[model samples]
Structures are given as C-alpha cells and as structure tokens.
Target: MDVYYFTEFPYAEFPESEAEKFPSMRLTFPNTYFDPNKAHDLFKRYLDEYQHAEDVGFDGLMINEHHNTPSCMDVEVNITGGILARTTSKAKILMLGNMLPTSDNPPRLAEEIAMLDVISGGRIVSGFVRGIGIESWANNTNPVYNRERFEECHDLIIKAWTTPGPFRWEGKHYQYRAVNPWMLPIQKPHPPVWVPGTGSPETVEWAAKNRYTYAAFLTPLDVAQGLFARYREYAAADGWEAAPDNFAFMVCCHVNDTEEKAQEAGKAFLWRMNHPLRGPREYWSPPGYTSRAGAAAVAQRRPTPLNELSYEELQSRYHLVVGNPDSVTRQLRHIKDTLGVGALLLEAQGGPLSHHDTMRSLELMGREVIPALKD
Candidate 1:
C-alpha cells in the first residue's frame, strides 16, 4: 500500500506548569501562534521531509485545504501547487483538494489545476470536497445550498477542463460569458478525480457512480471499514468492479520501537485530540446541509450550541491508531483487507504533538510498518 503524510505544521510549545496560571486551551484558539516566518521555515522542513518520504519509496505526497482552524495551516493547497511545481519528479501530488463551490471564481481553480498539472509533468490526483461545517460561515456560503453548489461546480470545472472552450455557459450558481481556458491539463481527459469525506452517504454514492477514488478523513479504522464496504456495495450495484486501487482511507498514526514509547511520545497529542479547538457546536454544520435530509434532520444529528460537547468526547471519537509499528500494522492490515483500500493516507501530525515526535513516528512507519506490509 502507498503511504502519504498529513502535515498540520502546528505551533509547538509547552503549557504553563501551573494549571491556574494560564487559561484553559479552549476550542476557539487561533492555530498559528508561532511567528509567521518561523512557521514558513517549519513548512519548508515539512516539505523537505515529505520529499524524503518519496525517496524512501512512498507512492506519493498529499496536501489538503482548511481555513482559520488551528487544525492546519489554512490554504496549504496553494502551497501544494508550489511544491508540485518545484519538487522532485514522480510521486503523484494529490491536492485533496480545494473547496470549489465556495470559491467565487471556480474557473480560477480550473486554471490553477491545469497550471500545476503542466508544471508537475502530469502528476496530480485531484480530490474535491464540499468542505466542512465552519467553512460555511467563513466563506459566507449558505450551508443549505452546499450540495447543489458543489454538484454544479463539479460539472462546471470538468467542463472547463475538457471542453474546447470559448463559449458562453450559465448555471443556477455560476455564469460565464466567455468560457475560454488559456491552458489545458497535461493529463488526458483530466487528472484522476478523488473525493474525500467522512462517511457521508451522498458522497459515497456519488463517488461510486462516477468511479472516483474515495478517501475518508479523520475517522477511526473500524468505522472506515464499514464505510468502505458501503462504497463497494454501491459500486457493485452500479455494475462496476470494485478493486483495491479504487479506494483510500486516512489513519491518524504514529509508530515507534514499542507501544509504550510511542504512547509517551504522543500523549500530549492525545491530550490535544481530546481538546476541541473551536465550535459554534453541532459540527458547525448549517441546517439542511446534507443531501439525505433537510436542515432539521442535519441539525438534530449535529445539535446547536456545539460548544456543549466536551473535548474528551471528540477525542475518543476521532483519535485512533496511536501505538507501536506492530500494533499499527495489525490494525491497518485488518482495515485494508476489510475495506479493499488501495492506499492509506497516514496522518502523522495532529493536535499539539511535538514535531520531533511526528518525525520519529514517520521514520518508524516508513522503516518498520510500511516495509513489513510490502513484504
């Protein structure tokens, strides 16, 4: 299986020794507490290390997008474009991807994607997402219209890339008087389309129907296995062959010589995982957001005043696969076999974990777990 590291580039610092001295690290904390220049340097280090993953024979490098969340360095997709443009050859660069519908000018996405594909010598796997709950508020988009906007945007983007262009196009959400794209992507038809999500049924069906690769983010292995099975069932119903190559799953992983050592290295991260960085509550999803139901049902599943949910509950639900290489291997093998997943996105960086801990985890994963899986 191929492995890709998820980098958040979180600010690294120790908490106050006296509990009473500092206020609690609440959910609404700003993510980039470190100096901007220092964060830039840290990001460069991450890129260098990611390149080393390819050197160690990983299948590819992965990058994602987020905004105003301490969870990641917001706008890293643009950074991915730069990395793919200048970094070493080979190893498909998966922009797992930009929030297309929310972008006022969707064609800019098409243009930038084509530019990146050309610069990277046609190595790019594009993953489109409707984005998450808070994004609605951040982007001034109606969460209610997210699904419609996304479907329309996806069609528009593919058309912009594939059609001869220089034509007028109009849709419910977008309009274009002159539809002429200056550049076409190097990948035939278009770069491979992969969609990432967290067990959304509509997404599963859409991915299955379109034959797009599905990557589940921030979910436990047990749950991910079930989700993948559902995807396969849909693929089968659609009269398609569901193979290992068709799916990918994300795992929050860290490995070391021993489980105890690994736990020690990642305890702070576990603590952070138990901590929620921000919320208006209810996964921050707006009413009537999901395709399966109206805003009321969505609200029921994700209650309002989302802040009421404690950090510990979030951690227990989200954090999984924190152990030694052998333990991680056993868990991953089971999930891979169960889900028929072709690739695994190994997220080594999370919460407030130390960079040293993350680097050590990556090394062990590459040297121990990944090699064993290969054999």
Candidate 2:
C-alpha cells in the first residue's frame, strides 16, 4: 500500500477555549483570534515538514483547504499543491482536494490542477470534494444546490481535461460557450481522481461509477469496509472488478520510539477532535446539504461523535492510531488487510502537534512503520 503523509496545516496558536464563544470553530468563529505573525511561522514550519516527509520516504504528500477555520490554515490546496510540486521531486502530490460545489469556474479549476500536474511531472492525484455544510455558508452557495453543483462542476472539469475542448458546455449549474484551456494536465487522461467520504452513500456510488478511488476519511474501519463493499457491488454491476487501488483510508496516526511517548503526543489530536467539530446541526448539515439517506448512513456509522469519545475509545475505534513503530505498523496493516485499500492517508500531524513530535513521528514512520507494512 502507498502510505501518504497528511496534515491540515493547522493554525492553532490561539487558545482552544476561544471556540466556546462562537457556534463553531469553522465558519462563524471570528478571525480576530488569527495572528498573521504566528501563521507566518507556522506556514514555514509546516512546509518544511512536508518537504521532510518526502525526503524520509513517504510515497505521497496530502494537503487540503478550508476557509475561516483555525484547524486548517490552508485555505487553498492548489496554492500549496503548486509549492509542493516545485519543492518535492518524487512524492505524489495528493490534493484531497478542491471543493467542487463552491467553485464557480470549472475550467479555471481544471487549469489550476493541470498546471500543478505539469509542474509535478505528472505526480498529482486530483481529489474532488463536496464541501461540508459550513462551506456552503462560507462560500454563500445554496445548500439545496450542493449536490447538483458538485456533479455538474465535476462533469465540466472532467470534460475540460479529457474531451478536446473548444466545445461548448451548457449545464444547469455551469455554462461556458467556449471550453478550452491552453494548459492541460501532464497525465494523459488527467490526474487520478479520488473522493473522500464519511458514510455518504451517493458519494460511494458516484465514485464507483467513474472508477475513481473513494477515500473514507476518519470513518470507523467497519464503516469503511461496508462502503468499499458497496463500491465493489457497483463496480461488479458495471462488469469490472475493483482492486485495492480503487480505495483509500485516512486516519490520524503518530509514531515514536516508545509506546508511552507516542501515546502522550497522540493526545494533541484531541484539539482537532473537539472544538472544531462542535457546532449546531444546521452549521454542520444544512437542511438540503445531505439527503435523508446520507444523514441516516452517517448517524449509523458514527453514532458517537469523536469529541464525545475518550482517547482510548478513539484509539479503539481506529480514528486515531498512536504507538511505537512496531505497534503502529501492525494496526495500519490490519486496516489495509481489512479494507483492502490501496493507500493509507495518515494525518501524521494535527491540531497543536508540535514540530519536534511531528518530525520525529515522520522519521519513525519512514524508518520502521512504512517499510514494515510494505513487507
């Protein structure tokens, strides 16, 4: 399995308690807490970490974007994707990914990704996402049109990359009279597309229909297994057998030289599991943002929220993994074996995880954990 290193590129210099003053840490939380100076330093440190992860033998580097949130300072993945493309030579740059529904221009989105692929010498895995409900508010996009815009924007971007453009696009959510961009992806058809989901049935079915990899983000192992099984059912109906490469699993992971030290450092993930995830139902799931079926699946999959779970419960559920190299490798391998996924997107760094601990964990993962899994 390909092991990818990931971080939300968090900006957690502020006190976690500040989130209590707002409905959530995401959309409505005031940016008054933001310190440009601290963020400047954090950005440099995080970029350095990304470069180091590549140097230490990670197969890929993953970055994501979110707006108005301290949990993830990266507001634009393409910007960081371009930087990683130039700085790293070998690691696949997985942008999981650009938000489809919130974007107004599909052709521009296509060009930006294509440019990154060219710059990276064809090492880009393009990930498409239907932004969370908070994003719909932040971008002022209608929640009712979330799924419609997501599908239409995706269709247009794919056409921009593959179909010889100069063609016209007339769709419900997107329209372009002349559809051609001078820049095209270095990868032949386009970069490999991956979609991240957490118990969204329509997402799984859509991904399977396109033969795209479906990454289950932070979902329980059993839930991920079920989602993958559904994907297989879809693929089988289409007369193609899905392989491990068609699926990926993402979880927060940390490794150190000793189990005790790893466990202690792993507690840093609690910051992420808590405040940022606390919000009203409307903030997280606007009325039309999710179908009734999707919401039901999500509730069944995660009956207890991560914030409500103790650290031990989190570990037991596989939402977070922390241990010495040997133990981490064993747990990750079990996930790989159980889900039959092609890749593991490990959030090796998360909320308030210090630079020293993050680097040390990355080093240990490269030296011991990753190789052990490969064997």
Error of 1 at 50 (Å): 1.7
Task: Estimate the overall C-alpha local distance difference test score of candidate 2.
Answer: 0.93
lDDT of 1 by residue, 1-375 (tens): 777766655544434232223232322354435467766776777777677666666677788876664446646585566675678687888888878768777787888888888889888888788887767766878887888888888888899999897877798899999878897799989999999876577887788888898997755556566667878899888888888777898766777778788767655555334333343444455665665443443334334222233433433444456678888887778767766788888777765665567667777787778887766
lDDT of each: 0.70, 0.93
Model 2: what TM-score?
0.99
Candidate 2, residue 75: how far the Cα is off, in Å? 0.5
Error of 1 at 143 (Å): 1.1
**TM-scores of all models?**
0.85, 0.99
lDDT of 2 at 372: 91
Clashing residue pairs, backbone N/CA/C < 3 A, model 2:
none
